[model samples]
Target: MVEQNFTKVKEFILLGFTADLQLQRVLFLIFLIIYVFCLLGNITMIFLICADSRLHTPMYFFIGNLSFLYLWYSSLFAPKILMICITDDKSISFAGCLAQFFFAAGLDLSECYLLAAMAYDCYVAITNALLYSQAMPLRLCASLVAASYFGGFLNSTIMISKTFTLSFCDNNVIDDFFCDLPLLVKLACDVKENYQAVVCFIMASNVFTPTILILASYLFIIAAILNICSIQGHLKVFSTCGSHLTAVTLYYGSILFIYSRSSSSYALEWDKVVSVFYTVVTSVLNPLLYSLRNKDVKDALKKMLDRAKVS
Candidate 1:
C-alpha cells in the first residue's frame, strides 16, 4: 500500500453523533443542560470541601482534587461537542485536535492515578486508623496528587507525539465527537505493528497499574472489615468507602468497556454511548456521589445553609 503523505493536512472534519438537524438541535440542548449541571455540581463540591474545616482530611482532599479534575475534564469535551452539534462547522484544526487529545488524555490519566491514591488512603484509614493522620500527612497527600498530574501529562505527551506523527491521508474525517487514539489511528495512512503494540502497552500500564493497586487496597480493606467483631463496626467502616468505591466503578467500568474490544470490533454508536458515560455522566454524578452518600458533607451543607439564613 502506497502511503499517502497528508502531513500538509490543515484540519479534520468531525462527524458528530447525528446528521439530522432536529436531532442535532435536541442534542445541543441536552448537552447544554448537562454541561451546566456538571459545572455547577463540581464547583459546589470543590467549594464545600474547601470551606468546611471538617473536610480537611485525606479523603476529602482527594475528592476536592477529583472535582477540580472533572471541571477541566468535562470542559475539554463539552464545548467542542456543543459546537459540533449546534452548527454545521465541524472542522477542527490539526493543532486543535492534538490539543484536545492532549488535555483529555492528561486529565483522565491523572484521574486514574488519583483514584488509586484515594484507594490507598482508604486502606490506611481502615487498616491503620490510629496512624492515618500520620500516614497521610498534608505534604504527602499533596505530593501524591502532584505525582498523578505529572505522570498523566507525561504519558499524554508521549501518546500524542506517537499518534500525531503518523501520516494521515487527505481523508481527515474523524468518526466521533472527540479526538480519541483509536479514531486517530484509523485515520493514519500507515500505522506500524510495533506502534500499535507500544500504544497498547502504554494504555494497559496506565489503566492496569492503578486497577491492581485499587483491587489490592480493597482486598486488605475487606480483610480488615472481616476481623471486626461487631457487625455495626463493619458497616460503619465500609460506609466511609462507599462513595469512593462507586466513583471508581463508574469511571473504570465505562473506560474498560470502551477500550477492551479490538478496534475492528468497535461499534461507534455504542462507543458514543459509553463515551458519554465517562465524559459527561460520570462527571455530573461525582459531586452527587460524594455529597449525597456522605454524612459529613450533608452536615457541612446543612451548617452552611443555616449560616446563610442567619446572614
Candidate 2:
C-alpha cells in the first residue's frame, strides 16, 4: 500500500523561472556565482571558528552549526536550480525531490530554533554576564543544539509524510523553482481541515515558537540594557545583539508572511521571489551576520590570511 503511494508519481517536472534559452544561460551564471560566494562565506566562517582558539565558545559553537546548516540548506536547492538552468531538464525523481526537500526542510527548520537558542545565549551573556559561563554551560549548549536538530527532524518528518500522502492524481509539474510545501500542497486533489491543522502545527513549531522565544529573550535583554546608566553600556548591548536581530527580522519576517498563512492563500509568483531570500540569500548573509560582524572573527580571519601568505 505504501509502495503504491510512492509509485503514484515516478517523477515530477519543475517549471522553473522560464524556458527561454538566453534567460536560462544568464540565470545559470547568476546562480552559479551566488552559490560559489555563499559556499565561500559559510566555509570561511566555519574555518575561522574552528581554527581559532579564541572562538571556542558557546556563541561560536552555534554559529558553526548554523554555517554548516547554511551550506547544506543552499546546496539542496541551488544545485537543482543551476542544473535546470544549464540542462533545461527540470525532471526530478520522487525520491530525489522528496529527499532534497526533507533534508532542506530539516536544516531550515533547525536554523530557526538554532537562532532562538543563539538569542538566548546572547541574553545570558549580556543580561547575566556574571553567570553566563555557568548558565550556558558547555554541556547545556551541546544539548540545545541537539534539541534544535531534533525539533527540525520532527518538523520535516511531519511535513513530508503529510504532504506526500496527498493524491497527486493529475499533473506533477510543480510551478516553482524547487519543491516548496505550499506549491506542492496546491497540487493535492483534496485538502481537509486535518491538512491545515498539520500545517498550522508545523508553523507554530518552527515559526511562532521560535519567534516568541526570541522575542521573550530579547525583551529581558532590553530590560537589562535599559537599567545600565552609561550610554556606552547601551551601545555594547545593541552591538552584541544587533546582527542577530537583523537576521531574525529578515528570516522570520519573510517566513511569517509566506508560511504562517493558509496554503490556499499562497501567491505562487510572490512566494517564489520571497523564498529566494530565506532559501538562498540567507545562506550568504548568515556567515556575515554571525561571524563577519564580530571583531573577533575579523581579527582571526586576518591573522589566518597573513599566516597563509607567509607559509
Candidate 3:
C-alpha cells in the first residue's frame, strides 16, 4: 500500500449525531442550555474558591484548577457541537480538527493526573492530621498540579503529532461529532495498526497510571477509616473523600471506556454517547459534585450569598 502524504488531506467531514431537522433543533437547544449551565457551574467554583478565605486549602486549590480545566475542556468541543446542531456545516478543516483534539487531549489528560493527586490529598488529610500540613504543603501541592499539566502537555503532544501525521487518504468523513485519535486512525491510508498501537499506548499510560494511583490512594483511605473507633468520626472522615471519589468515577469511567478499547473492535456510536457523559455531563456535574457532596464549598457559597444580600 502506497502511503499517501498527509499534507494533501485538507479537511474532514464530521457526520454529527443525527440528520433529522427536528432532532437537530431539539439537540441544539438542549446542548445550548447544557453548555450555559456548564460554563456557569465551573465558573462559580472558580470564583468561590478564589474569593473565600475559608477555601484556602490544598483540596480547594486543586478544585479550582479542575474547574479551570473543565472550562477550556468544554470550550474545545461544546461550541462545535452546538454549531453543527444549529447549522448544516459539519465540516472541520484539517488544522481546526487537529487543534480541537490537541487542546481537548491536554485538558482531559491533565484532569486524570489532577484527580489522582486530589485522591492522595484526601488520603493524607484523613490518615494523618499532624503530617497533613507538612506532607501536602502549599509548594508541594502546586508542584504536583504543575507536573500534571506538564505531563499532560507532553503526552498530548506525542499523541497529536503521531496521529495527525498519518495520511487520511480517501475517506475524509469522520464518523463521529469530533476528531479523535481512534476515529482518525480508522481513516488512515496505511499502517493503521501502528497508529492504533501508539495511540493505545499513550492513552493507557495517561489513563491507567493515574487510575492505579487513585485506587491505591483510596485503599489507604479505606484502611484509615476502618481504624477509627467512632462511627460519626468515620463518616466525617469519609465525607471528604466522597466528592473526589464521585468525580474520579465519572471522569475516569467514561474515559477508560472510550480510550481503552482496541482498534480491532471500535464502536463509534457507543463511544459517542460515552464521550458526551465525560465531556459535557462531567463538566456540568463537577461543581455540583464538590459543592453538594462537601460542606465547605456549600457553606462558603452560602456565606458569599449572605454577604451579597447584606450589601
Candidate 4:
C-alpha cells in the first residue's frame, strides 16, 4: 500500500512555560541555576564513586549509573531550554524533536528501573544482612545494571519507532516545554487512534510496570522493617532505605500523575510545573538525597577529601 499523503511538518514550535516576558525571564534564571547545580551534583557523585575504593560495591555501582543517567537526562533538555530562553526562535526540527524524545524517554525509563533495582538492593542488604555480599555478587550486580540500561534503551527504541510511524500533517505547534510523546500525538492529523494505542502501550510498559516493581519491593521492605524486634533495628533499616524511598516516591508519583491519564484531561500548565520536578528538581535532589542520607557515600567523600589534603 502506498503511504498516506500526509503534510510533512518540518518543525515544531514549543509554547514554552509562559508567554509573559517577565515570568519567562524569571523562570529562565531559576532553571539555569538549577541546571548548573544538577549537572555538578550528579557529576560529583559519579566522580566520588569512581575515585573511592571503599565505594566499589554493587550499591555504589548502581549509584554511579543513576548519576550518569541524570547527567544525560539533564543534558538532553537543558541546552534546548537555555537556547529557547535566550533566543526568540522556538522552532525545533522534526528530527531534533525525535532525538530529544528518544534520549529523554530512554533515560527516564532507565531511572525508573534503576531506582527499583536500587530499592531491591537495599532490601537485600537490610533483610539478608548475613548474605548481602554473597547474594548481590559483583557479576549479578553487573548484570542488573546492564539490564537496566538495556531495558531503557529498548523501551526508548519502541516508543520512538511508534512515534515515527505516525503521520504528521498541518499541526506543528506543541503545547509543552519539550517534545513529549503525548503532545506530539496530539499534533498528528491522521490515524490518531493507532498512535494513541501505541502511546498507551508504551506508557503502560515503561511507567506502570516499573512502578509496580518498585511498589512491590517497598512492600517487602516495609514488612521486613516491621518484623524487626528492636526499635533500634527498625530505625536502622528505615534510615538505610529512607533516601531511596523518598526519591522513588517523588519520581514515580510525578510520573504516575502525568501518564496515568488521557491526553485530553491533561492540564498543560500544571503538567509543565510537575515535569520540572522530575526532570530538573529530581536531578538536583538525587545527589543530595543519596549523599547526605547515605553513610557510605558520605564516608567515601570524606576519605577522598582526606586523600586530597594529604597529597
Candidate 5:
C-alpha cells in the first residue's frame, strides 16, 4: 500500500492565486502586462549595453549579465503562470514540476552569486580606482561570472536530487503558485526530523553564503568611502552603490523570509504574495533600477537615439 501510494502521484495540482474565473482573468491581464514589461525592460538594457562602447565597463558587464539572467529567469515561470491564470489548468506532471523547480532554483541561486560579484566589483572600483581597469580584466570577469553560473546550477542539482528522491505519497497539491521546495517537502510521507533539518540547512546555506559575501564586500566598500573627505564624494559613492544595495535588499529580504522558516510553519498565502514580488515584480524593477538611476546608461540611450535620428 505504501509503495502504491508513492507511485500514485503522477501529477500535482497548483492552487494558483484564485478559483474565481473573474479574478483569474484579472490576474491574467495583470501578469501579462508585467511579463511584457519585464521582457522589454531587460531587452532594452541588454541592447543599450551592447551598442554603446562607452558603457562597456566591469559595472555594466555585470549589469548586462543581470539583465540576461532576468530574461531567462522571468521567462521560466511567467508563461506558465499566464497559462494557468487564463486556462485554469494548474495540473503539472511530476517530471515537469521537478524541472521547473530545478531551473528556478538554479537561476535564483545564480542571481545571488552574481549580486555578490557585482558588490565585489563595486568595492574594487571604489577602493582601487587607479587600477580598476587592470584589476577587473575581461578574463577575471568572465571567470567570476562563469563560477556564479556553475555554482548555482551545481547546487540546484544536489537540492533537486535530495528533494525529489523522497516519496511524495497521496498528497499532490502544492499550496503555492510554484513548485516551492517547502510545500513539496510537506507532501513527503513519513519524513524524518533529521531529513527536514538537513533540507533546511542546505536551503539556508544557499541563501546565507552569498548574503555573507555581499555584506562583507559592502563593509570594505563602506570603509573605503569613509576616507573620501568631501560631502559630494559621499553622495557620489552612495549613488554608485545604491541601486545594487536596493536590489540586494529586495532579493535577500524575500528569500530570507520564505526560506528561513521551518517548512511546517509557512504561511502559504503570504508566501505567494512575496513570491510574486521577488519572482515577478523584481524582474521588471531591476532594469529600471539599474538603468534609470544610472547616468552612463542614460547617456548611452541618448546617444543611441541621436545616432538613429542622424541615420
Candidate 6:
C-alpha cells in the first residue's frame, strides 16, 4: 500500500485570541492569572487527597484523577498560548502541533470518562451506601482510572493517526490557539468526505457515549435519592452529587455546543470564548468545586496548613 506522502508543514501560525496589541496583552494577563490559578488549584486538590486519609474513598480517588487530568490539559496548551502572547511566536512545527493535539485530546477524553466514573461512584455511594466500599473496591477504582487513560490514549491515537495521513498542501494558518482537529482538518488539501465522516464518528463516540453513560448513572442516582424516606437523607444525597453535577454541566455544555454542531456554522470567536471556558475556567473550577464544596477536602487542607506551620 502506498503511504500518502504529506508536504511537511515546517511551522503553523497560531492566530491566538486576538491580534490587537493592547487586547493581546490584556488577554495574556488574564490567561496568565488563569494558568497560575489552575496550577495552584489542581495541585492543592492532589495534595489534599494524598495527605488526608479521610478522603481515601473512591470519590476522592476519582477527584484526584480529575485534578491530574486538568493539570495535564492545561499544561498541554496554556504554556504555548502564554508564550505566543508574550513572544508573539505563533510558529509551531508540524510535529509539535501533532504532539500538542495528542496530549490535549488524550487528556480531554480521559476527563470525559473520569467524570462518568465519578458519577458512577456517586451512584454507588448514594444508591448502595451499605455496600459502597464493596461495590467500588480499591482494585475496581484503580481499574476505572486505568480505563479512563486507556480510552483517552485509544481515541487520541486514532485521531492523530488519521490526521497525519492527509496531505497539508495549503492553508497553514490555524485560526485558533492550539492544533485542534477541526482547524487541522480544514488545513488539509486532501480533505475527503470519508475523513469528515470519520471525524464525525469519532466525535460522536467520544463526546456522546460517555455523556449518555453519565446521564444514565445520574438518572438511577436521582431515583435512589428520591427513594430515601428521610428529608436529611435526601439533602445529603443531593449535596454529595451537586458539585459533580455542576462540573459536568459546565464542561459538557461547552463541548457539546462546540463539537456536536456543524463546523460550517461554528462561530469562531464565540467558539474560542467557549473553549476558554472549558479549557481554562473549567480547570480552575474543578479544584474549587471538589475541595470547597466538600468538607473533607477543606479539613485536609487545614491539616496540611497546620503541619506546614508547625514545621
lDDT per residue for candidate 3 within 1-311, as digits (tens), equals: 96546556799988878889999899999989989999999998999999999898888999899998988888888999998899999999999999988888988888889999999999988988777778789999999999999999899999998877777677888877888877787778775577768877898889889989999999998888878999898887868788888888787678778877887666567878888778887889988888888788899889988999999
Model 6 spans with C-alpha error above 4 angstroms: 1-3
After superposition on all C-alphas, the RMSD of every candidate to the true structure, in Å, is 2.2, 2.1, 2.1, 1.9, 2.2, 1.5
TM-score of 4: 0.93
Poorest stretch of ten by lDDT in candidate 1: 1-10
Off by over 4 Å in 3: 1-6, 192-194, 261-268
What TM-score would you give candidate 5 relative to the actual structure? Answer: 0.94
Error of 6 at 203 (Å): 2.0
List the pairs of residues colliding in candidate 1: none
Evaluate model 1: give its lDDT.
0.89
For candidate 1, write residues 1-311 as lDDT tens digits.
97444576789998889999999999999999999999999998898889999999998999999999999999999999999998899999999999999999899889999999999999999899888889899999999999999989999999888888798767888878888888788878889997788878888899889999999999999999889999888887877788899999999889889888788866478988899779987889999999988899999999988999999
Clashing pairs in 4: none
List the global CA lDDT of all models: 0.89, 0.84, 0.86, 0.83, 0.87, 0.86
lDDT of 2 by residue, 188-250 (tens): 677678987987688676777888899999999988988999999988898788888998889
**How many clashing residue pairs appear in each of the predictions shown?**
0, 0, 0, 0, 0, 0
User: Per-residue alpha-carbon lDDT of model 4 for 1-311, expressed as tens digits?
Assistant: 97663648989998888787787788889889999999889998999999888888777888888888888888888777777776788999989998999988888878878887898898898889888889899898878878888898898998888787778888898877789877887777765576668767776777777778778888888898778899999888877788888888898789878877688966467888887778878889989988998888889888878888999
Clashes of 6: 0
Encode model 5's per-residue lDDT on 1-311: one tens digit a residue: 34333446889998888899999999999999999999999999999988889878988899999999988988888988888889958999999999999999999989989999999998998888789989999888888899999989998998887777778778998876788887887788866676678766766787788889999999998898878999998887887899999999899889888877777768467878888888888999999999889888989888888999999
Model 1, residue 235: distance off in Å is: 1.6
Reference-based TM-score of each model: 0.95, 0.93, 0.94, 0.93, 0.94, 0.95
| Model 4 lDDT at residue 200 | 72
lDDT of 3: 0.86
